[model samples]
Target: MVVLATKLYVEGDARERSLDSLRSLVDNELGELDVEFELGVRHDDFPSVTIEGEDATVARNVLREEFGEIVPDLESGETYAGTLESWDEDGIVLDAGQDKGVRISTDELGLGQGSAIQIRERYGLVQHMPLRFVYGGDGDPSRLAEEEQDRLYDWTRGDGRLNVNSATRAEVRATLNRAGHAQDYVTVERIGLLEQSVICTEDTDPPGLLASVGEYLPAELRCVVP
Candidate 1:
């Protein structure tokens, strides 16, 4: 069994949809390997898959490479994927499943993103956005992965949108409708359980949409500006 570091924290119908999405993602990545697996969610909401049949080890490695392995310790030179849990002037804290939390200082953000808040705003680094990181040992500096940097760069290039957490796709859509802003966005893309990216229409300002409909959604919403 391999427990992935990412989380699935939605409830009700959203929970079912998220589980189905996860199963499809894993299956598409591992189906060719002839592995039989059972997927489940733990109490803490982390996704886990137990594999059986021939070539199970190969299947496990495939999953680990696609998602990240949950670990209790951080070692120098080790790479990890974690949720962006919180941030302050000092740095950002990643919920990497550590006893405390993994800390990434402002200076380590690199790529000319400036302070922590600036980095978050510049990249649309919404809370619970899964990000890859490399850890450096004591007195050494850790950094975000190049792939992560590239992904953020891509988000900043197109029609910017709002990324939201702690709400279902239906709820978000309904909130937009209720707020009389249904025509402001193009679509809502579900990236994880309780997480979505609202693609804005050409005339819609992502930040304006966020401000107008945010109060009704009851979730944390951040805009990605192009």
Candidate 2:
């Protein structure tokens, strides 16, 4: 069994749809190998799959490559996907299913020039955002991937938008409607199982939209400015 780093935190019909989507995605990825598998979401929302049949080993490798692997423990010089759980004067804490939270020091951020809180604000690093990080033993060395950094940077250069975490696409859309801000965004893009990017209209302000509809949606909403 291999657990995927992606999460599915949506409930009700959205949760079912997300699960079905994951099931289909797994089937499509592993079907070519003729492997039998069972896919399900864990209590914490992480997806896991159990492979059977002769090609199980090969299938497992493919899944690991496509979806980041979830390990039982942290290892030095290894990369893992974790969710941003919280932040403090020390730094940011990532939850990767370990008994203790993994800490990413401010120096390791590599964002150049700023405290952890300032860096997070400049990059809109909302809680529960999925991030890829490499752990280096003592001296507290850990770093986010260059690709992840580039992606976050791009968001800052894009048109006014709101990136959301811990909600499904449908829920986000519904929240916008309920808050009377449905016309503010052009569309909702699903970045991960529970992560979404709300593309704001040309005249809409990302931060304003977040402030208006944020309370209605039980998720983290951050502004993206061009």
Per-residue C-alpha lDDT of model 2 across residues 80-171, encoded as one tens digit per residue: 88878788765788878777768888777777677888878777777767788888666657887677778877877767778888776777
Superposed model 1: Cα runs more than 4 Å off = 11-17, 31-33, 111-113, 168-191
Q: Pick the candidate with the highest TM-score.
A: 1
Model 1: colliding residue pairs: none
Q: RMSD of model 1, in Å?
A: 3.2
Q: Tell me model 2's lDDT, rounded to 2 decimals.
A: 0.80
**Residue-level lDDT tens digits of model 1 in 57-117:** 9999988887777776888988888888899976888877776767888887764657898
